[model samples]
Target: MNLALLFEDDFVSADRAVLTGRRLAHLNSVLKVSEGDLVPVGLVNGDIGTGLVVGLSDTEVVLQVELSEPPPSPLPLTLVLAMPRPKMFRRVLQTCASLGVKDIWLINAYKVEKSFWQTPWLSEENLRENKVLGLEQARDTLMPRVHIRKLFKPFVEDELPALLHNTRALVAHPGTDTPCPTHINEPATLCIGPEGGFTAYEVDKLVEAGCEAVHLGRRILRVETAVPVLVSRLFDACN
Candidate 1:
């Protein structure tokens, strides 16, 4: 296990403090940390720093910490995706978090199933849990905000323009004439459709709302593969 993982909501201050329960267990057994050792620590949505283990006991370990740096900057991306299957949706949410996406809009599409809107993963707690796992994996502290849009037309017509105001917008479509650019330098708003892809109407609506249809390649890629691949490629192009 990594020395820096997010534990429960432990209050952080300049003074020495004790970490008990699961966190202590992890340090004692998994990490096998000892007194005089420095461990990575951070407050949620706060700063990252080092904690010196000043005392250790069977029940707990005390650390004297000094917060030194601000949390990592967020990726300048807003992902708009059609809700996938329940299992895939959770994975997608985690992926977005791991990639440092600051905002996610789960929207409806013609190919999206009605029941997918009812997935347990859509619940606030479940969403946060998956996002936290991603944050922990990436050593990040900020959580991305998630939004659900059930009606496609209204969302595209009313809210899409404001969302794309100054951000470069890209929509992934398989057979589109324009290829998905390799890199993008500006902040981006990316939209990806469900498994079978977006309907013509949906595509037209989004295009009218300022999203340019972009293609990955001739081969059709699954939602999971397409997203990470596109994001990586975009990063390369921009960098």
Candidate 2:
């Protein structure tokens, strides 16, 4: 809701785009935008800029848009996470996108609930919708790409090599010898596990796959809280 999001299909000309449906209703009633409001807006996968509101109605609102600049760069981090409960997935996806995470890899863990994977939220369309909501909330374009790995062994042993080619990888576990570093400037690949956390064997596999084992602290954290805490720590460190 921070920015009124629109896609290129809505554009009638370089200077105008027509918004309808729920978006238009939101603009007309929720946001209560008016002529010359100068709304912050962006193309779905393009740029961040101003939209000069020139027209409005109950069903449609028109904006004269000028998209010339790309959004701020995403943090150079790839998040490899054990899929959490379905209920937490949407919130986590939005958090990751809003925080400017570049990539997300959803993997399986021994502690992961089997039923969690059956949730409708994993549907491609539902996933896309959550990501879109995140981008809109952030007032940025450039959707974060999500990847799924139903099996952990295959992903770690076969697919991870290419993904880790140019990245410093780290795995988050509670009982690791070393605490998670305060700051890391280079591109990093971070692995986070499920609620109960990764089994020792799972952690061993990731570590063998070139990920250094690290921890947040003595206290345990749920997946929802761990993601933002870990990402923000890394972001602060990199800066």
Using all chains and alpha carbons, the TM-scores for the candidates as numbered come to 0.86, 0.94
Count of clashing residue pairs in every prediction: 3, 0
Residue-wise C-alpha lDDT for candidate 1, range 154-231, written one tens digit per residue = 999999899998988989998899988866778999999999999988888889999999998799988988888888
RMSD, each candidate, Å? 2.8, 1.7
Residue pairs with colliding backbones in model 1 are 183-237, 183-238, 184-238
lDDT of each: 0.82, 0.86
Error of 1 at 101 (Å): 0.7
**Model 1: residues >4 Å from true position, as ranges?**
1-9, 12-29, 54-62, 236-239
**Stretch of 10 with least lDDT, candidate 2:** 230-239
State which candidate has the highest lDDT: 2
Clash number for model 2? Answer: 0
Q: Least accurate stretch of 10 residues (summed lDDT) in model 1? A: 1-10
| Residue 147's lDDT in candidate 2 | 94
